[model samples]
Target: MNPYLEIHPEVQQALAAGKPVLALESTIIAHGMPYPQNVQTALEVEAVVREAGAIPATMAILNGKCCVGLSQQQIEHLGQAKEVWKVSLVDMPYVISQQLDGATTVAATMRLAAMAGIRVFVTGEIGGVHRGAQTTMDISADLTEMGQTSVAVVSAGVKSILGIGLTLEYLETKGIPVVTFGQDEFPSFYSRHSGFGSPLRLDSAHDIASLLHTKWQLGLNGAVLVANPIPEPFEVPAPQMEWYITQALHAAAQQHIKGKAVTPFLLKYIAEHSKGESLEANIALIKHNARLGAAVALAYRQF
Candidate 1:
């Protein structure tokens, strides 16, 4: 066992018993959402996972421990805590060594989930190539981590605020398969359609499980991106999302928000501008992904 890893008893038991276990990221609690809603959504998502017949292991860092499954109290603390370190791949070691309260980004979560032997991960959205990356070169570490980590990520697709097309291209270049669930078109986080064809498509948890089994059986490395679309009724229209994103981007620039701070800033901006509709959409998609992740984890265990 890794000394740095503090696996919750429930998660440990599930893993040892060969039962399904779904890994969930914690950035959503620490920096992604606001106040009581963040805590509420975190608890709700865990329930969704458990209802699907799997254990939910929410990953975070607290007081130098790499916590695999946080309790409800820890979730609330992370949600209300200010200035929590949004730890990614590069910052993970520093946060742990320094005993800082840290939230795991997609990259950090995937890395730690793989370390803890959890194969399926759920998140609202995976970061990607930021808009105008040619000059700024502001690609997210999530992409790089996906290219190496072996966990299967269930998400609503890349944030619409990013270059979705470029993100797909980058994933392809990295030899990471991007499989859309029950859809031929790639989703755009808040929207159901990104106007791009997905590289692959799978309709059921069994299909995804089989694909993952085959891939790893052939000695393939890296993560499988399961792009689960946001539920249609909850989806914000592409045009409306585009407008909101543009407004948010302009404001980010004006405020000089850069680096890791950019995403949380933009998400809050969009939520506020959309009159909390975006936040609702975000919570909905994450819970939806949690269900799928649990199902996939169960199916994977069969192989």
Candidate 2:
């Protein structure tokens, strides 16, 4: 056990008993949504995992401890706090050594989850090759982390704010398998289609679990990117959402938002401008991913 890690008793017990456990990121709670909605969604997502028969370990950093699971009060604090650090892989050491409150991004959460022996991690969507990376050379660390981390990440898909085609290409270059659940077309976060074919497709949790087992057992290290589509009723059409994303991206560039600040800024901007349609879609997809993550974890444990 890592001295700096503090696993929740429930999560610890579940691990001890060889039960399925799903790791969830704290970035969604702290920086992804508005106050009350963020807190409410966090709790509901956890409930979804438990209802699916898996323990939910929401990862964060609090007072020098790498917390594997957070209390309700802690979740609320993260949601409402103004000074919480948006901790990514590079920010982990600084946040922990400084004993500050920090929300874990997908990359950071996967690292913590792997440390605690959790296999499947759930998040709304993942950061990927940003738009205009050809010149700016800007890309998210999440992709690099996915190339090495063994924890499987279950997400709606690459965030529509990014270049989905380039992200898929990058994942291929990294030898990271991108598997879409129940669809041949890769999803674009808020939308059910990305105009790109999925490199791999699996229709069932048991089949995905088998793939995870086989990949790792064959010494193919790194995370599997599970693209779970949002429920059809909640999906925003690709064309409309793309227009909104273009507007938001322009806003981000005008404001000179760079690095880690870019993602949250784009997400908030789109949600506010979309009249809550995007926000609702975001919430729905996270819950959807949580359900699938739990089912996959349960299936993985069977092996």
Candidate 3:
């Protein structure tokens, strides 16, 4: 009942009843995909979470209030809304103060999820150290939030446009646990392989839940990253995806797109150049993560 927060009744009940609840980000609806598809995917992901035995709480900002779960109408409006702010930690205050609509990035989502006592979050992928970040000092706020928050994030992986090696190293320095699900090799968001071995791998939701429980029980702080690979049929081969990413990155550079604009710009470029295949892969991976997130939340409830 805080003035700045609004929790949907279902999500509130789940929290009060100790039932499993999975938190989802809103940037995927507002800035991550095209209109109808964004709305469609949002609905589908919610359905997947419910089927997997949890309630879905898709977080966003509406009229300056942080909303923990969006209704169907709100989801549609968000997907079609104009000039919605892509909100991260730094943008939260401004968006709220201005009474503007805002889509929650991974960082913003994690922060709000922690505020609402929701421990499991699902998203398409995470932002990471941008390529050439050594020169630009442009690492994403998502990494910083991971170091400070307690939510467990289930994502496809780091967005492939980023410097994966550097991002992983930064995570190591911050002591964030990155655990790959089912595979020993970490995934690149659009593809099943990143050619980099994961530092840790847990094959099932129960195992992931156990790890999370133990970490918190031992008084460990910060988030747990669960990298879930896209299903094989939807995965673009690593080599092919790398080529597409290169083209998209170059295009972003040519357009002088940086900061908050970089990811959506790069994703749009890849989606267009790849004849919509990349978008398909993106949607598929989100659904996959939603399922895993729900399972992990359910299992964690028992801990």
Displacement of residue 217 (Cα, Å) in model 2 is 0.5
Candidate 3: pairs in clash? none
Expressed as tens digits, the lDDT of each residue in 1-303 for candidate 2 is: 999899999999999999999999999888999989999999999999999999999999988799999999999999999999999989998999999999999999999999999999999999899889999898888999999999999999999989999999999999999999999999999999999999999999999999999999999999999999999999999999989889988998899998878888988899988999999999999999999999999999878
RMSD of each: 0.6, 0.7, 0.8
Model 3, range 129-165, lDDT digits (tens) per residue? 9889889999999999999899999999999989888
Clash count for each candidate, listed in order shown: 0, 0, 0
Q: Which stretches of candidate 3 lie over 4 Å from their true place?
A: none
lDDT of 1 by residue, 166-202 (tens): 9999999999999999999999999999899999999
What's each prediction's TM-score? 0.99, 0.99, 0.99
Q: Lowest summed-lDDT stretch of 10 residues in model 2?
A: 258-267
Residue 33 lDDT (model 1): 88
